[model samples]
Target: MADALPWQQALWQQLASRRQHAHAYLLHGPAGIGKRQLAERLMALLLCQRPTATGACGQCKACQLLAARTHPDHFILEPEEVDKAIRVDQVRELVGFVTQTAQLGGRKVVLLEPAEAMNLNAANALLKSLEEPSGETVLLLVSHQPSRLLPTIKSRCQQQACPLPTRAQSLEWLAGQLPEMAAGEREESLALSAGSPLSALKLHEQGVLAMREQVVEGIKKLHKQQSSPSQLAEGWNGVPLLLLFDWFCDWAHIILRCQMAGEEVDLGAADMHKVLQYLARKSTPSQLLSLQDWLLAHRQKVLGKANLNRVLLLEALLVQWAGLGGKA
Candidate 1:
């Protein structure tokens, strides 16, 4: 298994050193902060026939089996398809697994990621296992948004908060991860990812930087009346809907902040500094607030994977955005 991330070292030690492990642990934190990695490490440690002081002994039989992905007692429950809900049937299957005897004569481990993906029915089904855990079973629940989880679910498990790396730490890690990229580019990625180094690395790999440039240019053109909403929407076809919404939501916030806090407030990304300043000056507080509310509502729809007409949705957003600079 891979080593815990640099920022996860202390959290790892605290968890791995525990003599008494909990029946269920909810590792909650922002996405891309290594919470899943931490849970996996703990799962290995729990299932290992011979665990080291720090973690699992890689040479052990149990460890080898886990590494090979053939560990009988180990279960990973997630949505069958990407961004889909973890259905009630899936949880029932896990419930069945929870009732089984550990084939390896050790502990049974379950890793259910993004626990919020469990719909109401699925979460209720999983609650049965949490309420009355069977055998030496350990459940590791990883969630990016713990607030979305049921209160009963949170009450049952030992909640562990995985922390975001500090800005300096994130930049340092990004430097090593993206060695070929310039310092400014790496910093931009880190900023875009909200100081999550792993997320920054992922965003870099996904070519978000190039997409960001294209988006900024498009927005500038839209503001100039050189590009219409439909044209820019079509141009941004390659960009992820959630990402686009996030950027717009952030821009709306920055524009409002600039209006309220004057030039003293930070304007977020350097690329949008002047643009945000201009919008702040031209747009009234109510216009920006209303636009922000709309962005947030639609952003949630994107997060929920709503069946939306992407072109039309993007056009609507751009139209509202264009109207923000009314009478300018």
Candidate 2:
């Protein structure tokens, strides 16, 4: 297993020093932080035959099993398919596993990521296991949006909040990760990822900078009436739907912010400052607010993996966007 992230040092010490581990721990935080890593580190320590003050002893039989992904006592419950719900059957399997005696005769650890993916039924199924945990079993639930989780689920586990790294820390780490990228470009990536270093690195690897440039140019063309909604929607065929929605949602928010502040507010990045300012001036607060509401609603749908017609959705978004102001 990988080492804990630099930002998680203090958090690791706090968790590792515990004399008695909680039956279940809800590791809550924003996406792209290292909550999963922390949980895994804890899991390793819990199952280690010979644990050090810091963490697991890598040479131990238990650690070897874990490293080889053959640790019978460690269960990972997540959506079998990405961005899909965790079904009740999966949770039922987990419950069964929880009842079984550990094959290694040590602690049993279960890591459930994005715990909010469990729907009402699945969560209810998991709840029984949480309420009546089997001997020496530890459930580590990792969630990006804890608010979306069932109140009963939240109430059962000891919640641990993982915070974002400081701006200086993120920048320093990015420098080491992306040495070839210019400082300004790195900063832009970090800003785009909402200050999440790992996410920023991922966006960079996905060529998001180039994609952003293409999108910004397309929007500019869109405002000039040189490109129609259909055309731009087709043009952004390569961009992820969720990413497109995220950008549009953010732009609407910025425009609303500018209108309310009665001046440009420098939140961080300024990729679309002039365009957003123009929209703020041209569009009424109600128009921007309405657009924001629509964006937010659809963004949730995208996150929920709704069955959507990509072209139709993008066209609808652009049609509303084009009608935001008379012209740009």
Cα lDDT tens digits, model 1, 56-106, are 998899999999999999999988997788999999999999999999998
For candidate 1, which ten residues in a row score worst on lDDT? 260-269
lDDT of 2: 0.88
Whole-model lDDT per candidate: 0.88, 0.88
Q: Backbone clashes in each candidate structure, one number apiece?
A: 0, 0
Can you give the TM-score per candidate against the true fold?
Answer: 0.95, 0.95
The local lDDT score (0 to 100) that residue 153 gets in candidate 2 is: 96
Q: Report how far residue 2 has shifted in candidate 1, in Å.
A: 3.1
- In candidate 2 the C-alpha lDDT for residue 206 amounts to 90
Clashing pairs in 1: none
